[model samples]
Target: MFLPPLNPQLGLRRQLKTIVFRIPTRESPQKPAPPMHDPASTWNTLKDILPGTDNTVATRVSENEKRVLNVFGAPHFALLPRPEPHRSPSPYEYFCTVNESASHVEQPRLSVTKLLTDAWCELQTFYDVFAGLPSARSARLSSGTRHHENLEKQAHPRVDARRVEKQIESAAQKHAPEAVEVLFGTPMAAQLASQWSEHVTMRLVEMADTCELREIHVHGFLDLARGSLVTDAAHVRAAVLVNGVVDLVRVDASNHTQREPWLEEGLLLVDLSCAIPRAKATMTALSKDHFVHVYDVKTRQNDTIPAQRSVLDAARRQCMFYSRFLADLARDSNYAYQSWLENGRRRRVEPDAPLGTGNATELLLRHFETLALDYLRLARGTDLGFDDFDNSHTHRQKQNVDGPEHASRYTLSDFVSAAQFREMLAALYGQDSPFLELDVTPLFSAWKRPLTLRYFAARAGQTCNILEAVVPGSVGVEYHNMHTRRLLKRMHFALDGATLTAAVQHAASFWNGTRLPTATDDMKRCVYCLYKNRCPVKNRATEKVGERIYRLCESQDGACENLHGA
Candidate 1:
């Protein structure tokens, strides 16, 4: 039979999974034990018995000293000792307190790497739970089996510094010089940077290397700035390919310039708005009022829904996160800061503020208000539904493993049991209904949030180019969303990145002697080639002399009898 333990400390707090015990014969006690040692002194005496345990009294005194100093040095830094749950104040309270404490400005030196590592830990925690990935150490227990050991053992292993350093070094070699430095504090950042490096090295390395292009400049707001073109043709080609729309503007120094032009012969005018990285996911614009404004072409139209409370809440959160992240970008590199000055010279700039973070607070608040209004209206009584989808979720999950055994094993069967859907819908929609939907949606449902997959590309101009070369004849302003996912997909071919680099090299060799050979070599027989068909890169195996196959197919005059020889 289960019984309670007789420890006074245990009586105060009930720990989960703790063993319980009780005295068998309380009435039979004839005499009380000799005066027990004082509770406080006894606790102190036992402290040294625990391995690696420090003297609590000394630790507490030190902590108190630190707290006092913190208060005296910068009162704003003296946060109250948070309770167990550790929650910050409400948004209003938080902002008010921060504003009130603005008089004492103390810029504590922050370690970017430490911040990144913490963020990665949080991200992994969320992803592991959300994606339902199999834990490396989940174990089966018999009925009535204790779960303590299993639970403790199932945790993801801690990362080692050496492994992290290796990843960082790899990232520096492949993606960009700044990638390694920018990833400080994020554990997954190192892994992600390495992955980006591998991909960039495979696809963009050869093209850039052949053209004698060196570095890629990524603008914090607009897009990218490309460097190292050996010839004017290469630069023009890069400018055309990198940008979707050529913004007609003079490159005046006073107006501010964030560009790195090798030749100052002419004003550098390139498209900022249209150039989207190929691997970006589809995007849909919505009004501040939560109205459906536009749909991204790649997403399924049927799944696109109007902004509701949930949508707006998510948007506000996203905008704030992005704003903060962009703020960090300014401090990450000299180029980013320069670009901000050049592009935003006309805007009212802050002298002391980092460019990215300059209007972050206001922008975040404004965007949140706009989204909130839309959500409020939708929640009141708006009849609207959203429908935009793709098999991207499935595709991403598939990337974790290589073969049939590694395929998307997560089926609907895994989540149908329990009150999961009902609980979720209740939280999201504020009501339970038979019409409520439940399925594993993509991890990134909103455009404002960062994507798990990133597209690493290299071009003649800019660090993060936004042009879409997937479907030809739709150049310039015709390109669509250039989010992480879309940019990744685009680089698969044009960039021939880490995973597909070998395939591109082999393809380049196959079409060495043919006319328009490089195109044929790069597109056909290439694993990364997503647009082999109708692209000049694909081999002309079916083409015959004097035959206009492309024109014949594109025409509306019933496949041109003369061209087809019908």
Candidate 2:
């Protein structure tokens, strides 16, 4: 017969002795001798003799003493349980809070990115937004950001410091000679002078016509009930504020090739001198207009070139959303004009308030002013005095050219006034209104056409393997290897109005609190997800812990066991 060991911590000799003495032989049943030392006392003695044992024992003793004192002295307080911590608000609630503060609306503001992310994996997006987790930084993201910044720099090139200083000196000589000393006497003064000119130069560039516009900001609201752009707040089932930046707006004069013969024929009989043309006179008004094409660039890792079906779908929706926003802004001339005027008026009244307090118009204006002031302060070492400029007049009065002696010093205030600035804004808005009307079509109509998605692969900080996808048009998606430049695979499809609408509505339902965020059906996505460890919906069967793997078993308690042991 076998006997199990009683005291696991005992020495082999001591355990054998205890066992031998306890087992009675076939001879006679005798009274058992007592143990030389109590098992508990022996364990206590061994614990005291071991290294670091005193510290551990002291800690345990102190904790026990404290517990005893608390029970005896303040039993009522010690027995009381802690109130449960306030539960964190859900993603939808957090969104509402942000919306109310920014736009003074209870409705949540959704971005093209957010909508796409929701479509990709609503559960992941929920954790991202609710927990406010910072996006994981990787080489691919950094490469893409650097590339975009380079592209934007091409549009608004830095002003030459030498040229700016020369202009400042010439202006000072003509108007205020003493002002030159104040401007160029110190390094701080000289720096500020350069910044002022740079700001003015950039503003001029923005007002002027450019063939390619990078990072054009756009925003508007979508009405869920009518499936149209929201204008008034009244009689709305629900409104979702959508905003996004157009990566690139290429002014293509070639769009005229797509113009129908009937459109051209109709335009020939209409009057050409009118400022605003009728709907039928689209071609005539568009004669001088250039078509604008929106492009969104996505950077991917080497393996992600031939993206999954879900990723491709998300990209298509993102581009469509951007195109739709641009079209809405372009088609509604009255709204755009009014928004510009209202924002400018508000900006004038409360110049100190933050940007993005109103619509995109206010956001743009405030951004310009803030940047201008920042540059000036960096150069001049002081706030460029806004009080120096006159705001009494609605328009700047033309001064006599002959009165050089009477001319004021060259300051940003003298270069542009509040009313003049507003006019410049109007002109900027006016330039694009006609072009957007002629080039952009409604979302439903535009979706019928094939949208292109370009995926760039980066290697050693350089981008290559430009894979382009013509959705709904091509049969398969084609991937190009970054190093070898070899074609990998092909795939393609197009979007329809109903499909796009359904996808958007499904995503909106989650945001509107109609349903909770659902986990992605694609198990592959969960493998690399940052929140997989904590996600309740994660596939526990495939969960890897150190060198071991586990699989969920169909037990009543829903327990998981090691695969090796199973």
Candidate 3:
């Protein structure tokens, strides 16, 4: 059950039309002049250069390959395998806060995807996050993925110079034009070519001015005439994970509004440890002072520029949510950064060392909020394993009581960290205070530190205009996104205080047996939505098996009718 918007539509019956009332007048096809196979015309040259159907597969490279090496960093071999966090299925219907004291209550898990989708339509998000339901992929979405994956293959440096010509031949055989929408779809493929032209034109202009002749690794699009590659998807791989999980952690920090510390203000995390190649070996420029490098090597795939712009705008809020998560983790636990030195030894870093990417080869404990005092204990917790424990808290308690291993590989720094973490958690969780105060120096270091998380959401920044570039990576120019930011500032990642009061209210109403209204906005998202069959807002729906078709009507007890895009 879901609640309707405060202001309902004036006439719902008038709007729910199965058939498109207005149709475009059809025009007869006219005979056109034959395409002049002239040298001056670009189309003629494109026909000659664009390879015919053959091998479409570009030579795919591994993560450790020479080209992507700089962007993704070196191969990470783990010291000890880490297990994933356990997750419980979330319910869409929000209930009264369960009294865990009387009986155990599970906290709802919220993600950036959930928050963003919830903003779109509460019911859809409820189905996604709460119901744990999976939706079938739409045709457009599948095509978009294919298109983006194609660009990724082309971005590899191996596809450069003489190799590119051979790759073109491969593409000709495998990537046929009419066979799939990804290869030569209008607007998407056309828009990609158009944007690629802009990048090549500007780069050529700059090259002419500087009289530069040195070879540089260019990206997705290539120049058939100059035998040069034009970079396209460099801006796309800012830093985000393919799956839903973003590196998440809790941090302690002062509230921007009240100027005081807060709990439940958790930070969302992104670990870009391998972004810069040489930086990791040197361990200096990589992670310097306040900033720690995070990498997400994902590509963009938006059809339009304005749509891409909108995605970049929405990402700021997501980044803010992540920053807040880090701040909360710092506040609640005794967290310190320890790095492995070049001399085959790990040492205690200052209050802010893990914040740096230097010597961070291990991606699992790459950088985490220490929930306890001593890191040695943290190591022991991992040694025992996660299978026995039901939850994070229970896992921590059992790790201590089970007796630490004597023949363990725990280091000196780990011992100190484990002790401090234990002490910190004891005092903080013991007494009930409006807000917990963390260690003086660490908290102070975090206070002055400007918290920020870098996002490379593939869908959003597919067409983000270039601001700065370092060959494989590009930065997007920031402009004020006031309207979107204002809306985002009101929401919190976790339910704390009044930040998520509105969200909880909606959930509570639904769980209380309130009938949730359909948020389907007419034809906007209804046509392609997987939930359309069950959705009330949809006036009509069609189901097909291969060539056969069956139309589903909204009116009760109505007979089936044959229709196409009605």
Best by lDDT: 2
Candidate 2 Cα lDDT to native: 0.38
- What ranges in model 3 sit over 4 Å off? 1-108, 129-131, 134-303, 306-317, 330-400, 404-518, 540-566
> Compared with the true structure, what per-residue lDDT tens digits does model 2 show for residues 1-566?
56666665764433334434466567865545533423344435334333322222211223322332232253321221111222234344555563324432322456677666555677777655543343457876676676666666677654343443343334345445554443333332222222222322222223223334566555556554344556532422245556576665444454432322212222211111121122113323333544445566554445456346777777667766665555544443344323322222221322111111011122123233223222223123232222121221112234332244213232333223334334434444344432123211121121111110000000100100000110111112234343343444443334356666776676555555455667688767876665553454553321232123112233324333332223
Ranking by lDDT: 2, 3, 1
TM-score, structure 3 vs. true: 0.26
TM-score of each: 0.18, 0.43, 0.26
Worst 10 residues of 3 by lDDT: 336-345
Q: What is residue 500's positional error in candidate 3, in angstroms?
A: 8.0
Query: Candidate 3, residues 1-566: lDDT per residue as tens digits?
Result: 34444434563333333565766699856555444323233333233333331222322232222221222232222111111212121232221122222111232222333334333454454433222343437675565445434433343212122332232234334434444332222322222222222222222222212222111111121122222222222321221111122221111112211111112224222111111111222222211221211111122233122334324433433333333322222121111000001000101111111221111101112122212111222333322121211143255355653234222232322112334433333343333422233321232122211110100011012111111121111112222122221111111222233432333334333333343423635345444544433433442211111122122233324332322212
Q: lDDT of all the models against the reference?
A: 0.24, 0.38, 0.26
Judged by lDDT against the true structure, how good is candidate 1? Answer: 0.24
- The TM-score of predicted model 1 comes to 0.18
On TM-score, who's better, 1 or 3?
3
